[model samples]
Target: MAEVRAEMVANVWKVVVNEGDQVSDGDTLVILESMKMEIPVISEDDGVVAQLKVAEGDVIQEGDLIAVIE
Candidate 1:
């Protein structure tokens, strides 16, 4: 399993994948808005999305878990 974490403090702008969705490495799972910039949070390995720890408009801090892949 892999834990996807936030790279910086930001608001979750969009969620691109949901639980049970399959994703490959580099595939964007969510988009975050930080300092007026959109940053994509990507998958590190091919796996099914086991959990989504955030939602649109939610504020997240650096190192916060964003999603879990298995």
Candidate 2:
């Protein structure tokens, strides 16, 4: 399994993938808004999305768990 994490403090702007969705490396799982900028959180592994740890409008800290790929 692979864990995707937040790299900065931000509010989740959108979620692009759902649990059980197939994902490729570099696929965007969520978009984040911080300092008025939109940032995409990309998947680092190709696998099924096992968990979504965030949602739109959620405020996340740096290093927070974003998703799990299995």
Candidate 3:
């Protein structure tokens, strides 16, 4: 399993994938808003999304868990 994490502090603007959704490496699982810029939180593993740890409109910090791909 691969644990996706936030790289910086941001608000979760959108959640594009759900649990049990199939995903590939580099796919955007969620979009984050920081400093008026939208940053896509990408999945690094080619597998099913086992867990979604954040929701839209959530304020998250760096190193926060985003999702788990397995």
All-Cα superposition RMSD per candidate: 0.5, 0.6, 0.5
Q: Compared to the true structure, candidate 3 yields what TM-score?
A: 0.97
Model 2, residue 20: C-alpha shift (Å): 0.3
Error of 3 at 9 (Å): 0.6
What TM-score do all the candidates reach, one by one? 0.97, 0.97, 0.97
lDDT of 1 by residue, 1-70 (tens): 9999998999999999999999999999999999999999999999999999998999999999999999
lDDT of 1 at 66: 100
List candidate 2 stretches off by more than 4 Å: none
Candidate closest to the true structure, highest lDDT? 1
Question: What does the lDDT read for residue 13 in candidate 3?
Answer: 99
lDDT of each: 0.97, 0.95, 0.95
Model 2 Cα lDDT, one tens digit per residue, 1-70: 9988988999999999999999999999999999999999999899999999998999999999999999
- Tell me the tens digit of each residue's lDDT in model 3 across 1-70: 9998999999999999999999999999999999999999888879999999999999999999999999
What TM-score, to 2 decimals, does candidate 1 have? Answer: 0.97
Ranking by TM-score: 1, 3, 2
Clashing pairs in 1: none
